[model samples]
Target: MHQAALLGGMIHDASHYGWKVAQPPHDWRKMAEAVQNHVKSLNWGHRVQLQDRKVKYFNFKASFVNPHMVCGVSKGGEETLLSADHIVIATGGRPRYPTHIEGALEYGITSDDIFWLKESPGKTLVVGASYVALECAGFLTGLGLDTTVMIRSVPLRAFDQQMASLVTEHMAVHGTRILRGCTPLRVERLSDGRLQVTWVDLASDKKDTGTFDTVLWAVGKP
Candidate 1:
């Protein structure tokens, strides 16, 4: 996903600064295809399937052994140990919804779920200003969805102000609709599988509601 962003025009103004760097833009889809082929080469057991649950810890017994590095994995009904001299714990972070918002999970879709979408969204209102938000909105809009970015304060608040502003401007010119100074309250699911977003504009004591195909949360992502 990080590589996808680099190829999707995030590298234009990002390369000059010493902050973040990306290679010269190339065919992102091609890169992704190449990666997929490489992964297929390994012929690693069955494709890893998710049960949509949290992994509390590594159930390491360090006993069961195999010939390859990933000797064993948690699959079927077994937690067989893999044979290796060193094991790296690369389990990444978890999804965290906004504290004030309710039913985010009920109506919202996390980054993990976005890639597997079967249909393209007609409209997407992405919430949050972090890098996740920026990249997701950019990707969605680039794919021809009407993407609206909503932020409570400023987008990319953690980054340097200048770079963040540059990203914001680039996104605007490319067709991403950015709505600043707003936060989502809840996502209301419609019968048609679309979502109705209820958001509070921080600048004004008013509420706004709109229908969207999906709502992406990128606010201070955990």
Candidate 2:
């Protein structure tokens, strides 16, 4: 994802008039394709494979049958039961959406979608204070996109506050607009293909609004 942003920055620089020698215009479609291909390569061995080793891997829907037994259902609807001395669950998580906010799920994307975007998300508004939120906003700003991060409270609540401040400060120094102590109230789509967001500053108890091409929700993973 960072590579994608770097590629975008290079493209922007080459196209800007300040360059002494003009370079060929960047092909967004080609860049997007390259990013997708690279992502696919990274997942080449995602599936577990078994060969000469005793370890076994299964690609199916798994459920706990007992404390030491599991049942798996394959794509063909075949069921397999296996027993072991120990069991481990390693399934990851998905991004959490602000369900209480109007138009959140229907209009917003998550970190999962950003890497897979075929085109740039222009003038992005990233909502959250998690590391994921800051990272996404950082990349977007690095790529020369108009990016903003709205933090409802302290940034990176789970991490060291001082280090988190430095991270956010660096991002701000690089051009990411930071809105602290603010929470989004709602999001609405404009006819011109932009997102209009309404939010409130908790400290001031005042409302504000902004428009962006994309609204990303990165509150956290639950």
The model with the greatest lDDT is: 2
Candidate 1 contains a number of clashing pairs equal to: 0
Model 1 misses residue 100 by how many Å? 4.6
* Model 2: per-residue Cα lDDT over 65-149, one tens digit each: 9899999999999999999999878889999999999989989999998877778888999999988999999888876779999
**Global lDDT of each model?**
0.70, 0.86
Off by over 4 Å in 1: 1-73, 77-90
Instruction: Judge candidate 2 at residue 25 and give its lDDT.
Output: 46
lDDT string for model 1 (66-170, tens) is: 443553444454555444576565656765767568768777776655655554545888887878888888877665568999988877776899999999999
**Superposed Cα deviation of residue 27, candidate 1 (Å):** 16
Which residue pairs come into collision in candidate 2? none
